[model samples]
Target: MENKGNSESTTTTTTTTSTAPSTESIGVAKDGCNSSRILNINVGIMGHVDSGKTSLAKVLSTSLSTAALDKSPASQERGITLDLGFSSFNVDVASHPLLSQRSEIANHYDRVQFTLVDCPGHASLIRTIIGGSQIIDMMFLVIDINKGIQTQTAEIDQIPQESRQSKIDTMSTKLRKVLEKTCFSQSPMVSVSANPGVVSEEANVNNNQQQQQQQPLQPSQPIGLNQMIDELCKFIEIPKRDDQGTFLFEFDHCFQIKGQGSVLTGTVLKGSIEINQTVQIPQLNLEKKIKSMQMFHKPVKKVVQGDRAGICVTQLDSKLLERGLLCTPKTVPLLNGAIISIEKVRFYKNLVKTNSHFHVTIGHTTTTAIVTFFGNKILDQSTPTTKEETGSIHQFNEKIEYSFMEYLEPTSLEYPVGSQFALIKFDHPVLCPLESVIIGSKLDVALDTSGCRIAFHGSLLQGIDASNRQILHDTLRIFKTKVKEGAVERVHSEDTLIGKNLFSKQTDLSSFIGNYLFGILLVSLSPLDYYLNLLLKRVDKKTFL
Candidate 1:
């Protein structure tokens, strides 16, 4: 069967010219090797299923990895990306108008490598899409030029060729409006066609037949590719990197090589790693020495934060690992539960109730957790109206007094403003670093529903180990209020009074004695089980009764 949804092939052309360097020299490594620095930035391609996301990635990429472009048999058979696909292309730093102006960067860096992360857009693969989003520095929301934005694009009457450009602009405007409620509100939208000349139904049929036969087909010239590249370089900002911090790597693909042991492909999240360096997989509690490392098939001595690379390690079973973290020994903690700073997604219409189960995604892992809502009195009084105010208020502080909440009020109500928090008890232990972003979703919600599945997003304030739960409880002041009512039976003496139904048989009378109750001092408790005598001081007997 032909996979009509597979992206058409494209040919990219590049030209190189040699030039003599000026007096300012590029940095060199200790070994005296000329180190031409290449900065890597991850860009995610996302949209609804069959929205031409994979097609766009294919057209832009110059180098493809083993995991790139629906390489899986299942994905190819389904004609959609089933997992994350990785590919990349390099752009000259001096070619960009903005980047060339920065003498400091242009002097040190030779090129910028844009790693395209192709995320599956199918509803059933939303978890995979979310995992892919975590690693990307930016995103491309692709829309099928013919059909525009859709949950799943179906066969429709083709639009007249003359009106296609106008349609693309209209779709871009609609996409911007939809993104206004999200963090990507300021993101730019670009219009491009990966396969510009394959618009006729007969050509599509022929391409599908060729794909079914597993034959390589000639690519049509792409449209707006240069413009897209220009837009990318202009808007892209180099993110701050922490190469000196603890080493952390998130592996999304692992496979065994017959004689080379196993190779793990992933992005470096923090710090740096070198060949022969020891790294531990905390989830499996396994440690292995890095036998070799490669960045897009080029051997590299070291890889720093934000770089996409594949590490080969000996004496490790690749089948035993799929997706997890590799970090410096003992760097990531195993969390049984966690207290997180939370904010409701305004688009989510449902109430977040206490003890409710949610699919909590931390880093690339998604696991079920029971959520308990809590907040300080400050939240009850006022709500933050803007992102700036919300960030300032919702920060977790142990000194702030908090009370248990039955449920988080919907955004429709004015009460759910200000700082909100949640104690998440995970069903399974997760290896997570401190301050990691946590996303809560109701994944069980029907995919057909128009409502947003993402209920909330937050950051981990504190992690709770199974053994250290008590310490957290004692450290944070979370209290519940209780009230009791009773009638004064009669005046027992000049300084005392008898109260009835005040203490139940199960109630600890001694606890009430010497304690303040509704501003009245409970001086003592009587021996009688059904009645208790309260010793009142500095009060008339008639008034006390």
Candidate 2:
């Protein structure tokens, strides 16, 4: 990959390489200028209203001549970056022991690229933030000095833990299956242990405790933050390949330390940050050195992703550092504008009467921008065929009227918001690559049963010739079909079986994912189970080649 940088422009060269390493490489032409390799780091800049995310993004990107902020004038006039901004700065990865071995590592720091993302800072846009946060490396929460840990902050605290747990649970289950298979291969006749099924048992018990904890412990109960953070660490995925991985930096606050002029505090999401490392704030034209660092209160030689650290920088002042600005090593690409493919969104109410400016939050960062819904158009309260510039437009043009609001207008304020009516194309790019996509529906249990049946049948039809695939796929499909048909058919077949009696037993996606994984694990461990081996042989006869 070759990249060129000039006073006015910078270009990046990226290619997906095969497993084999090639001599073809990205080179820089600028003499004396150090070549920097871009590191992928997803940093979510978040804060309350007026926390200075736009100010910070400008300073960070201006140094590079191109930043996301440059694309929109609305950001400058409002003094608020209403859309998520992306800018890359090079950071020195040489200090990282793993990266130092690469000859090109040192050259990469001079142009350390940081993707500057600005998110909406209000509570209304939390869902938008969550959508991006699921994909990013880490989150940078900007805490306003005047107001510490606002309601938004408190709300965010629960999210990291919840998401972390879900990931951990998912990973743990996967790991357990792998281990179980390995063990079965080693010992062919091992008995299935249900007695304190170590991992599974602990998870079950802990899950109960977690449910209790979520409900709010007794006032006297000992709930520790460290314990929660420690639990979160188990799920946090670290880059295994070392070089081509991502890191996260959650900037909680920016301030002027007594001795050091400008400083920031946040936890590194994945990679490491070292002293004297140059950090770039693109909009500020400020490239500063880390004078010192401290993690978990103790002064440390360096900090890595996941470690909360306090950083003191040279040159930039506290005022110059804003909420959304990210200080990154030069080798990473600044998240510029992204052409996101978004599934459609349908509003539930009359959005023309409400606020025109809909908020977009990516990770912890917040921005307010126009959400143009692609697809169909609907009528307003006046039932006018004319289009209004009030809210995001939908795909449908027919004035279809339905009572009982189920969808939300892009302009209408709603929670747990989602859409499927059309594709959404952001006017400006946000941090993540893909737009929020809604899968499945939230209909009644009866509908869920039928939906699962439909999903499973679709999967089965796609794999009719393959025996194993057929069995597995057919089993799932049949399971759902049975559930739905039984509930409905049984209601009349056996007067004893009532729809109301079977209403609460609907299966959802979670069950689907779990069951699918469990089936995979059983097949992977077939050598240990004679019954499974026999099952496989029979199923393989019908496999689709």
What's the lDDT for all of these models?
A: 0.72, 0.35
Q: What residue runs in model 2 are displaced by over 4 Å at the alpha carbon?
A: 1-250, 327-337, 343-358, 370-545
Candidate 1 residue-wise lDDT, 1-545, digit = tens: 00111111111111111121211221111222234587788988776676666776776676788799899999999888899999887776765666677776688787777899999888878888878888888766665555444556544233434676666566556655766676666655555556543333233356456422223234345555665666676666778888897999998999999999999999998899999999999988988999999988778989998999999999888889898899999989999999987778877898888999999998789999999988754434355555566565356788878888888754432444445789999999999888788999999988888788989888888899967888887887877777777766775665565678777889767666565534343445555422332334334333322
Q: In the order shown, what is each candidate's alpha-carbon RMSD?
A: 9.4, 25.3
Best by TM-score: 1
- Colliding residue pairs in candidate 1: none
Candidate 1: residue 174 lDDT (0-100) = 63
Query: What would you estimate as the lDDT of candidate 2?
Result: 0.35
Report RMSD for candidate 1: 9.4
Looking at candidate 1, the ten consecutive residues that score lowest on lDDT are 1-10
TM-score of 1: 0.78
